[model samples]
Target: MSAANLYLERPALTPAAEDLREEVRTFIAEQRDSGALPPPERIGLGFDVDMTQRIADRGWIGLTWPRQYGGQERSALERYVMNEELLAASVPVGAHWVADRQSGPVLLKFGTEEQKRFYLPQIASGNCYFCIGMSEPESGSDLASLKTRADRVAGGWRINGRKIWTTNAHRVHYMIALARTSPAEGARHAGISQLIIDLKAPGVTVTPIISMAGEHDFNEVLLEDVLVPDEALIGTEGNGWNQVSAELAYERSGPERWLSSFRLISELVDVLGADTQPSTQEELGRLISHLLALRQLSLAVAGMIEQGKSPNIEASIVKDLGTKFEQEAVRVARNIASAEDLVGNGRAPRLRALLMHAQQYAPAFTIRGGTNEILRGIIARGIGLR
Candidate 1:
């Protein structure tokens, strides 16, 4: 409750984590040399099932999970280092990203022993995939205001509602949906529950919601009388609000938040060397400084999670500033391209394509996961300002 709670001590990575970073870099280099993982023309996490399997083959998928669950029992900081390298190079991790980052952790924390045994190994092996089913068409960032209801049925729960902005729902195998299990009562957060729904089951429909970047990564899923067994319920019947808050902490604090536009920035740096105008140098320096600061804050949150602490407020702060930095990076990249004339005459074609894609994707940076407005409110309330 004190302002001092906002202080985030920098995390010192273990030697093992640093070594893991080099190993990941070597893997990336090998993949690129084999022409399997080429530089992407577009941004965001690229999807490649083969690439995911290769990562799993190296025991990198669930790096920090228990060995019994097909993990290496490594440190969270090691996982952090591996992900930083993979994402920085824009590795095709889309296939297993959701399962590894959010769903696997959620299951580990709240699922029954049977559920963990059933899903964790598959996720760690990169054979299974998952997507988030939190946002509703009408609910925006007010998650407690969702209308998706899962009424108690004969064998289990019969779900009937729609979920929007579901990332990779079409390609993934399952979705952990947040639905109203019981009517809202004393508090709106009550009665909410998360249920793992089979995307291939009958009465489940997935429709694409393409982004301005002309990608089919987002989808809207309709659940019509979808019946799932009682075991599908994650955590407790009415404890979904708490579980989702924890899941969002994972979603909002990763390097993905600040590193989304990193490739574009890197491309800009390559196109504009040190001999550029002093004004340009200042702009580039400012952008890089913001990135380093965000990385430190993100590392602090990762360390807290490893220590069995819930740094939800700190996670929100990271996402809030990190996403804004992403948007700014896009603008900076575009401006630098225009000023340097790097995009003219088809010169620096890769940078041109990346800048174009980033511009289209930048607006959604603050919108996804949770809106900046909503995150700021969480930060204010956490600091006792509200």
Candidate 2:
């Protein structure tokens, strides 16, 4: 099917799924009230382990996985409600975000029974965390050109390469990395394999890469002669490219894509009183309309995933549009209020902090997960334009 002719039908959430939103909101409120979680403005792009554990105890981590895997066996719509609420509240979900969103599902799809038995429970329980090792210094957007190599050894594979911009690498216990298992034969995607590498291994080093905002969530991971057991291989050798593609669909098309700047909007509303100017109101309304539309698009993708269909093109669309919206939100908020006044005066400390953080973080919104240009190319290809 040509991408231009492709249509993603809108999917409605069940009443039961809609009800899950209130339950999630209540849980978040209780956590905030009990001081278990910081206010949205204070939260950076990192997760709190204790908070993740608390969420796991509620069985919200693996909401759609099997019962034996410590999941609630719920529908994707239900998971969507919970995830959207969490991101909207700016909860610190970074710790288990990768694991719950992608790693667990990947393992379920490709891991051996033993691998599933060992990792799924831990991930669901929030005792284990994971990072993605895809982009390297020389190969950021062009993942097919990654130079990380893993050679077959006696009982395992010895990996040697570096992965840059690895989010949560310093905090995660494991990384699901892609490496070259053999020489490139025809395509650059050939001979690539996915391995579950232990981050605590002898030759594995994670050096923090502070962002322009001075956040320490990203790292440069170096693997030198790091041995991963044969059992750690995910799916088959030479299939990493396909597997990672699937993983990126999950990574790119989520509530986080648009909701990353939600706090700015929330604060904007608070700062702009109910008696604000009509023009400002119109602008805010426009942002809300875009947010609503993008959200429905994202939910449709979630439904596709639940139906066992890969919505790669649709996901790319969401990430592209959603990221543009995020960047636009920052611009609107900046124009609406003076960040300097808010920071200097204690009247809007929370708004000031959120604005400061969002301003610095906005530039990367279009870069991470996938570059905007790359996503547009994928979209064009899907639509038969490329």
Candidate 3:
């Protein structure tokens, strides 16, 4: 049970990630000094359209997307590495994170040629954005119970329902909505379809909800008989549930789960200085160990995704543990410094900003993507707990 044993068993980063890692580091450093980068507040959660466009201009947004969509056509592992670098630096990636991570690939796999041509290039250019419309007033984790209905109208379908907890919906142009196409028949999970609805459609209405931090990143969107064209349907009818389940495998797994508090990590290390005490080292070591474990598990999931396999159960485990690890960083950050010191923290301006940000945002780490309870239930079912 030596450190070397744990280190040796650690999954090493592929060479592609290693090379891409340095390139990203250099890019961030240049952006930081040039004022091209937003403040640390904007790093992880800020809304900076120009910065997002700059990152997209660098061809770093959709690295794994097909070349036909203006992507670099890189490996998933490479994209993983790129994302790790971006998150570690706390870049303003909110604009392209969804498209690059989940929606674009899902479209490439199931979308019609017309859909691909319209959205992919725009996503690649950082001009198009999408919000997830899976959660409804009654249906949060229990997606099959969703009541959103889509009735077939002449040239398209009329969508009517309200989606709650819709993140960034007010700012985005489109949402990938999951609607019930037909009444439930044999099973609760049947007859649902995915539609790409324009947020600016005639009948669509968006209202912002301010969170504890006074941020309006969350919104509620009411679709009142919104008419979406026939081409807006993604994948196939009655297959939305399965498609979303597979897509969650990517959404739930990745460095973002573990590294959301990276700013706090950097702050802690700096505030404690390089000459921290033994107890501090022990606590830091524990967080580092958890991060390593999550990294390996996430890497394995990335590999499966690269090979076109859905590692759903494995992703649940990674996300569950990783979010817990992120919470730990927040918990200990408070204990490491006195209340006065925390507020007066000027040791490192950027890192202090990050720690303050973490303290306010840590609670959402588990709730936003999927609650810890929801993820564990899935894992238990996967392991035959039923």
Candidate 4:
């Protein structure tokens, strides 16, 4: 595809999908009223097991999969709308986010019927949680250069290596890890395979890495001769690169990409009035316009997914733009708050805490999933620039 075909055609949501929004909003309101979902002082997908179970009780997880696999068989656009409402309200969806977003879908696509039966239902029921195991200590975004290895052994594979910056590794039940099972043979992306690892295995150790925001959401996971049964291997052997690439699309092109700082933006809106300066209004207008455009592009990606097409390039575009917009949101919110004198006034304590948290968290915007440079490389290659 050339640069001319790079832009995704915007998708229109079906009436059914649009109607699902109110149901989600009602659930959020109920959670809030029950004290299950409190006003967040920070801006991110929070981890709450009870909240995840409540969402699962609503059949929100795995909404697009086949009913046999415990999904509602809904459209991807419907899932997108549901997530938009949930994130806009700062719902704590971190517990089941990864499994619902990618792991379950990947299993549906490449896993055996046995694997699907064992894993999909549990994920849908919010009984199982998963985390990504891609990054290594020094690999950065070059996943092909990972040093983790899973050697063939009797009845299983023995995995040995380290995964750094693994989000929720300490809390999640399992990790879908990428490891080299054969020689590269002059192809760096070859000889790789995906394996499911139990986080509580004997040889697996997870050590917390506290973020600058003082959160334990990140961790360093080590695997020393950790053996997983042969059935743990996902899809074909020596095919992990393609699998991980597809999984990255799921990770990159979600509402979470752009909406991490939305609470801060929404709070800023609450404090800003008609008497606000024209300059702030202009900045706020531009920010919102960009958000709307990003939403359209993200929806287009969801449309592609619904049609069973992989929009890797389009997803990278959305993530790149979305993450950048997130950082800009923090900067704009800070300026607006300073201008409005909303901080330290005791009138908007939640906004003040959110601002502080967003400032500490903003630096991670472009680095997670894939760095901006790596995403741009994917974009360039897709457009025939590389």
Candidate 5:
């Protein structure tokens, strides 16, 4: 494909998606009013079991999957609207985020019938949570260099490896892990496979890795000869690299990439009030402009997924730009507010709190999922510049 072909086709939200926006907004408001969800400032990673189940009961968890798997079989555009509303409202969606976002899709595409029947419905029901097992101790962004290995056994495979920076590993019931099943042949990407490992299986250990903000979301998961049935394999053996690459489009292209600090932006606006300075307004306008453009790009990616197209290059571009914008939003918020006044007893205490949280969390925005440097490299290759 030529560089010109890399351009994403414009996507427009349908009327159904527009209606879903209001429905999701109303649900979020009800959750907030009932105190089931935390305030934006206090919503760290936003994981709430009760809240996830509530969303599931509304048939919103697996929005784009087949109805046989308990999904509503809605369009990806509708899922996009629902996701944006939840994140913008700072709803606690972390519990089912990964499963709903990628795992379910992966299973539907590549899993055996038994695997699909066993896992998809549970995931759609919000009773199951999953974490990604791609990052390892020495192989953070260089996933091909990962040393985690799985050896073939009589009835299954015995896995022995440690995964780091795994979000919610301790709280999740299962993990879709990528491990080396065979030695690298000609390329490093070869000889790898994905497995559906039960986190509570014997010899599995999960230890929390607290963040700089003192949050316990990240985890270190160790698999010590953990055995899984042959049915645990996601697809064919020695195809994990391809499977994971395909999944990255889902992982990277989303409203979450840009909306992580939206709470801070909203709070900043509230603090600035009606009679704000021109300079502040200019900065806010610039931020909003970038956000609008990013949203369009992300929506285009969603449309591509709905059409069964893999927009990996576009997804990488979105992630690279979105994360940079999130980090910049934190800086702008900090410059607009005084630290002393922010920490002091003020009318905008919640805004101050959110600003502080954003600052501490800003560094990880570019690092998680994939680093900004890695994303740029992918974009360079995609554009035929590399």
Candidate 6:
């Protein structure tokens, strides 16, 4: 197929990424003019159910999901364009972000027929949301050391463990949990399994972890003998390590990685016009360079995903670099301003809120979705240095 045809034809390879961008931009403009969406906040606390429902109503949530699953069967590039525009506008997209990003794709690729049929459509329709269940108290970055255990039962399995730092745990419907299905034997990574645990299950408990920004985003989930049916097992029983690794690439390379500070970038440009100071000018230039570089790297990974290749290392690099840039953008913005935004003095309340919010959440940009150290390890291994 021609490049345009190839891109236009599939959700993963939309030939019309540019056109899609404009369309999304127009939608964001309309939303802004209607006062339906808040001004850009640079923070990633973009969760508005009504706004999410609006996106879903417009069929943007599952741009790349299969039609049978309620998606429009768009290409990855199309979805990429849509995602960039939404995050740029700081749209409240937290509800369906995780499901649309990776969980939906993972299920489509590795789940059983029953699993796909039940969950995929709901996800595409914005009815089902998912959070990750990877880190535990004892195991934060070293996922191989996670202690969340899953004992086998006749009909299914009984899960018992605590998952910390689960984003939107209280609102999400499900979690893709990594647990020990069996002992790892001699291999540290063996016998692990991914279970699709219903958050509303009888023994499940979610406790909020209010962030420094005073937002209730992260939570600690306790799973006590939660029964997961055979259908809840994603992929093979012992291949979760590899499966979740692939999913990380999808999580790490999306527009959200770079767009978190986009609001701040915009404000910096608007407020600090032609006569910016030397230090402020230097910082802005650096942020732009890093943003563009991360974009190129992330776009390359998106191309790989469109072409059915897993670009885990590239994803990690983009995630690490993009996250750092996002944090730096906040710091630069905070420093450049006269510190009035801190108390909403000269700055708009929305901008002040977002700025203060970004200050608090900046630490999480590197911490969440895997740490900087872990990503560097992945990149180093990719280049044969590790």
Of 2 and 6, the candidate ahead on TM-score is 2
Candidate no. 2 TM-score? 0.96
lDDT (CA) for every model shown?
Answer: 0.91, 0.88, 0.81, 0.91, 0.88, 0.82
What is candidate 6's lDDT per residue for 1-386, written digit by digit as tens? 23311121222434588888888888889998999986665477566778878888888977887788788887887787788778877788999988888888889888988888899888877788999999998999899888888998998999999999899999989999999999878998999999999999999999999988777888999999899887789999989999988888888888788887798778667766687567767777887888877776666667778878776776777788888888888887787675323334464556566678788878888988899998988877776675
Where is model 1 poorest over a 10-residue stretch in terms of lDDT? Answer: 1-10
Residue range with the least summed lDDT across 10 consecutive positions in model 3: 1-10
> Native-vs-model 1 lDDT?
0.91
Residue 3 error for model 3, in Å? 22
Which is the better candidate, 3 or 4, if ranked by lDDT? 4
Clashes of 5: 0
Provide C-alpha RMSD values for all models, in order: 1.3, 1.9, 3.6, 1.4, 1.9, 4.5
Over 62-158, each residue of candidate 1 has an lDDT whose tens digit, in order, gives 8888999998999988898899899999898899999999999999999999999999999999999999999998998888999999999887999
The C-alpha stretches of model 3 lying farther than 4 A from their native spots are 1-14, 38-43, 339-353
Give candidate 6 regions above 4 Å deviation: 1-15, 40-42, 339-350
Residues 1-386, candidate 3: write the lDDT tens digits: 12311111233568877988898999999999897765454225555688789888988877888888889988888888888888888787887778878888789888999989999999999898888999988998787899999999998999999999888898888899999999999998889999999988899999998877567889989999899998889989989999988778878998888887777777666566667667677787888888777887787777777777767877888889998888898877766655325446355566566666677788888887789999999888877776
Better of 2 and 4 by TM-score: 4
Candidate 2, position 76, lDDT: 85
Comparing 5 and 6 by lDDT, which wins? 5
**What would the C-alpha RMSD of candidate 1 be, to one decimal place?**
1.3
What TM-score number comes out for model 4? 0.97
Pick by TM-score: 4 or 6, better one = 4
C-alpha TM-scores of all predictions = 0.98, 0.96, 0.92, 0.97, 0.96, 0.91
